[model samples]
Target chain A: MSVLVVLEQRGGKWNRTSFEALAAGQKIGQALATPVTAAVLGSNIDSLATEAAAFDIQKVFAIDDAALEQYTPDGYAAALEQLIQASTPKVVVFPHTYQVRDYAPKLATRFRKSLVSDVVDLKTVSGGLSYVRQLFQGKLNADIPAEGDLQFVSIQAGAFRAAEPASATNPIEQFRVKLDPSAIRSKPEAPYREAQRSVDLGAAPVIVSVGRGIKEKENLPVVEALANALGAELAASRPICDNGWLPMERQVGSSGQTVSPKVYFAVGISGAIQHLVGMKGSKTVVAINKDENAPIFETADYGIVGDLFEVVPALVEEIQKTKA
Target chain B: MKIIVSVKQVPARDSSLRVDAQGKWLEEADLTYEMNEPDAYALEEALQLKEKLGGEVVVLCAGPQRAAQTIREALAKGADRAIHIEWEERAAPDALTTAQLLANAVKPESPDFILTGLQSDDLGYGQTGVVLAELLGFAHATIVMEVEPQGDAVRVKRELEDGWFQHVSLPLPVVLTIQSGIKKLRYATLMGIKKAKTKEVKTIPASQLGIDLNSGLVMERIYLPTRSKKTQIFSGEPKQAAHQLVEKLKFEARVI
Candidate 1:
């Protein structure tokens, strides 16, 4: 029995979810007594392969197809399905990303297999495995198990710890998988990059996110200054985006980018499940909300029940003094 | 153009829930039920469309008998007719199965357009509409915020990331998942509510749909999160204090 994890990458680098999926697959692999194999599909994935090598991965199946240079659900599903059948993995893992979301179900349906997606927890069941998923926007939890072979699941980003690279020296060998490019039906159009995605907040270790509590659009300078002072990225809640206070990429939620920054300081943000699903996996959640009963406090590791306007400047001053 | 809207009754958004001793699902008691918020929004959109374009609005639901209350409430709010699938055997089945039951009922009406809330409030899988689109082989767009109907096709605006919106036109026999709160729900009129008691609410069972995909997804266990005091406070000179907090946040907390 072996575990196969499909790592999501773009332009050779791993996406934010790759780290989470890798760690989760390793966790399951260790319990199953099988080595986790990583699958990379693209024209090239040097950086991703190097990152995968640091993990407890036994082998990296790197398939380079021009058809895969850009992601199309049909191409991705076909390639992953091929590698999956060839590897004969007991379980197939993927990051719950937009790219994966579009095609994971299609692939699952093709094989007549069930796909348990956005998994929050996992355990080895009596004869197999069981997983926990959020129902109704995190208001409820539903634990389900795989009843058939070739089990498939997509891990929500930040849901699991990005386990430190394996202790022992693990050799990383790349395996080439044969592909029939002609079989790809939909040739991707010229990649149209979103003009505003120049700054990817996912890589920022420290993010200072402002919520609706920030009050007015003019008050954004406070959070921006705070972010600048701490050398952190600025993020926002869905409301802020809905009102045009910030760019869409800056919004954190289930539909937006799921972030796992080292320090996520939330200001004026009421913790809605839609927003919590995006940032709950952060290493440390610090919430500054005047409302003590705010749900954000539940997941917040450190919370100050006070006005963000009063708290932000005071905290920024302390940081400047330390810099001096 | 007649429009048919399918809605579901679900636990209120604010209802507190917990797993019972059995662990198969959340405690149903002590929970208040309502018309699924998004579905209410869809029904409102349909009523408005019917008002503007001169047609009839039909509300369809698939559930047990208690759901009649929700259907009647819709009728009171102005739906011309109501269909409730009375399934005593299955409390809740997956979307594809439910779609078969809904499609079996709604197909006869031969409405020009069909709309449903993005997903059930209880199971926020956000898949039912898309799956329904595939099952019915109708063009579909999820996350639809605004909709306008043409003679042969329908135009819809989809919500995208970063405050972006796209408009697309899909030919008839299309399904569009309605995003909640595009407009506020209209209250049932006192006169309409009185007349609603006389409207017909039909009931059917799942066994009648006749299509089967083994229900592999089953609710096995559920539990609430353990309560813990997780809070931190930072003090001192603004800049330096921010630096210290940033250090703790990055190395120790890692939320940045």
Candidate 2:
């Protein structure tokens, strides 16, 4: 039996999360005693498949098709369904990217299987494999067991680190699938970024991020003052940017920019999984939230369980004094 | 055009969630429930589209008897009618199973458009709409930020990762999972609430769908997230804690 890891590619560029999925599949495949094969689907995915073959995969399938040049739920689902039916793999692993989110469920349903999606981690249990997924935002995690013979899994981004293959000499195989034009329903225009220039949070040395605890738009200036005192760039969680309190570029999370500043000051942020994953790599994490049990404290190197309104002003004064 | 919007009742985002006695699910007794955040956006999109394009907005939800409250809320918010798929199964149903139940309920309606939230705030599988589309043989898109109808086809702006967006065109009978924060959510007026009482709610039993309830992933157990870093809490007055934080940031962490 073999496991299939679907490699994501767009415009001849490989999505980095594809490597993360391959890394995860290799680990789980080893436990289940199954070989892992990486499959790349697109018109010109030869280079993408070749790059994937450098991983620890047993084989790479270059599933080239004109219909796959642009992703449509109908097209990708129909194509992958045929591939799965032909080569019955025990499990199929994918990176939980937006592209997969578009078509993965349709693919899973075609095979009459469950799509255990946005899984954070997986482990081999007594008799079967169990995937871990967060519930109630990030407060709880559930270990889900696979039930059917053929299982589909979508691993969340950054859940697993990408590791190199044992050697860079894996074999690559080319496969073609016939797709019906009539079956492909959605016509896509060229994808474009709305913002002409996005602020690169990754290059920032220090970032002061705010979360839901900031309460109102007026309170943002309190954290803004703290950010100014520390001489750090201002950032925020999804809610702040969503509320138009901050520019979209200033948001740090799975949907926002991933930042690894030398110092990350999280004000009133409860550290939801999405927000945490974006800033978890910060060298020094200092959290200021009123709730003692907020998840942000769990990840913070230094945490103050008090009202940010009071703490932020004091912290700002102290920082200015030290600078003086 | 007839549009169907799938809405779900979930624990309010700010609710203090606690694990159940079985350690398998959340205890709903003390938790407050409301329309899922993203699904509310989806309902708003459907209502706006109906108002502009002249169609009936039908809200569909699958839950226990308590879900009727959610359906009624959707009706008050401008849905013309509703279809409630009462799920009596005790086992936690997976995304595919839930989609099947919805597909069975939706097939008879043969609506030209379908909309659902990007995901529920609770389970957050984010796959129900796509799965439902597949089961019903409808073209689908996800993370939809904008929906514009163009004659026989519809154009949608879909949100991608890293602030990128893609515009796509799908023919009639399309499904879209709406992303949150797309537009301002509207409140149900007093008149709308009264009108909702007169709207039709077609209730169907989950057992009547002839679909296997236990056919997918099963939750083995659930527990609180394990903390990787042992956080040292700074107590006392706010000023003292702030002073201590600055000292630690400078002397211990050395980031400043």
In angstroms and one decimal each, the interface RMSD of every candidate reads 6.8, 1.6
For model 1, residues B11-41, the per-residue Cα lDDT tens digits are: 7755666667887666778678899978888
Best by lDDT: 2
**Poorest stretch of ten by lDDT in candidate 2 chain B:** B85-94
lDDT of 2 by residue, B95-154 (tens): 899999999999999999999998888888889998998889888889998999998899
Candidate 1: segments with Cα more than 4 A from true spot: A1-4, A9-14, A33-90, A111-114, A125-128, A162-273, A277-295, A303-324, B1-3, B45-57, B103-113, B146-172, B181-200, B211-214, B227-256
Q: What is the per-residue lDDT of model 2 for residues A9-49, given as tens digits with 9 covering 90 to 100?
A: 88898788888888888877987889999888988777777
Report lDDT (Cα) of residue B158, candidate 2.
91
* Clashes per candidate (backbone, < 3 Å): 42, 0
| Residue B103 lDDT (model 2) | 96
Best by DockQ: 2
Error of 2 at A80 (Å): 1.6
- On a 0 to 1 DockQ scale, where is model 1? 0.23
